[model samples]
Target: MTTKATTDDTAVRTSVRVDAAPEHAFEVFTAGMDRWWTRAHHVQKGELKEIGVEPRAGGRLWEENDAGDVCTWGRVLTWDPPRTFAFSWLIGPNWQIPAEDAAGSRVTVTFTPTDTGTLVELVHDGFEVHGPGWEGVRGGVGSDGGWPAGLRQFAAAL
Candidate 1:
């Protein structure tokens, strides 16, 4: 994996290679998210049931718990199959959902065809939109347990 984040960069960037074609890789990331997402990163209490993207711009990025409660991670901002996807990240720095009026971060992921497989790149930015504790929010997402860990799990799943 390659991390492009620097102390001065506003975004957390990382990428990995997945042993699959762009189309297959994109499907696994969108429709098959639950298969690779870390259960330890569950957004709510109790068991995680599923995590998924709704497959279109303005659609939902959500997770459902075993108790049948569903949490919206955010709304999908861009959704071009076999290429790229972007979404809002609504969960706050405190690990809790904020009010409806609160601002959220943005995450963009792209898949490119490669000689051996697909090169998946992810960039998480817009932390300043969160206001007061924006730095903490940035740090948390830039951590190893954030995008890095998720990408590793994702690549290994394929």
Candidate 2:
């Protein structure tokens, strides 16, 4: 994943490129974000009940816990099949960062075909004034870290 510092702001942008078909890649990435997303790495680990995406603009990206409680992880901001999808990243209070300032961010995943394979890019944009922590989260949870493993699980499912 590519993590960059903004020129005139405290926000950060992160991206990743993957090798897979566009449709396949997109489907896998979305469907599998929960599977390979480390339980130990999540804020609602033992309590995590269910995780899923609705696959449409205005659809819900959510999770539930054993207590029959649920939370909105995000909403689908844009949904273009086989091409791209953008969602609100409401991982605020769920993260190690301070809740008061963790207003959350955006996650945009784009799929493009190349001569060799598909290029999957995941961008996490927006951050508070705290620089290193944001970068650390982006780097830790993206690319071959969390999402990639999820993609691999998705591929296996297919």
Candidate 3:
């Protein structure tokens, strides 16, 4: 079964159970990020060539296009493999990178072992950082085509 709930106005939470171990689930979600990311969700004009998480705290979370242009999404805040991963989400309400990193939000994903599989929970918060158009940021991520759908794709990959 899938699960999703809003913790507050500023945050969106979603989860899914995957038929895989916590380690494997985490691997696919991070190391295999490009495989599950929604192609149409990107802000770039070129086709997405790769989506990457640099695997360390403070490392870059970015995506590259076919033209070799790179868009920096944010920085990794936490990288406890197979357990927890958190990163700054720097895309603004305009669907573009903001003028300052402070305008971004945060995303955290936790992997917990379950009897049947791994429970992967994701939370994207701090929408208020977007300031004037913060609601749009919150609404977009909480929409059906957002985190919930992304988690579904992640589960399907496993």
RMSD per model, one decimal: 1.9, 5.2, 1.5
Model 2: CA > 4 A from native: 1-19, 93-103, 129-158
Clashes of each: 0, 1, 0
Model 2 C-alpha lDDT versus the unseen true structure: 0.60
Q: What lDDT does the true structure give each of the candidates? A: 0.83, 0.60, 0.85
User: In angstroms, how far off is 91's CA in candidate 3?
Assistant: 0.4
Q: Write the per-residue lDDT of candidate 3 for residues 1-158, one digit (tens) a residue.
A: 56665656868998898889999999999998889998777767778888989999999888888898888887899999999999998888888744544556899999999999889999999888767888888889888898988998888887
Query: Given candidate 1, what's the lDDT at residue 15?
Result: 86
Off by over 4 Å in 3: 5-7, 100-102
For model 2, residues 89-148, the per-residue Cα lDDT tens digits are 666533632343345567777778877566655666674423445665555455454555
Candidate 3, backbone clash total? 0
lDDT of 1 at 73: 73
TM-score of 1: 0.91
TM-score, cand. 2 vs. native: 0.66
Off by over 4 Å in 1: 1-8
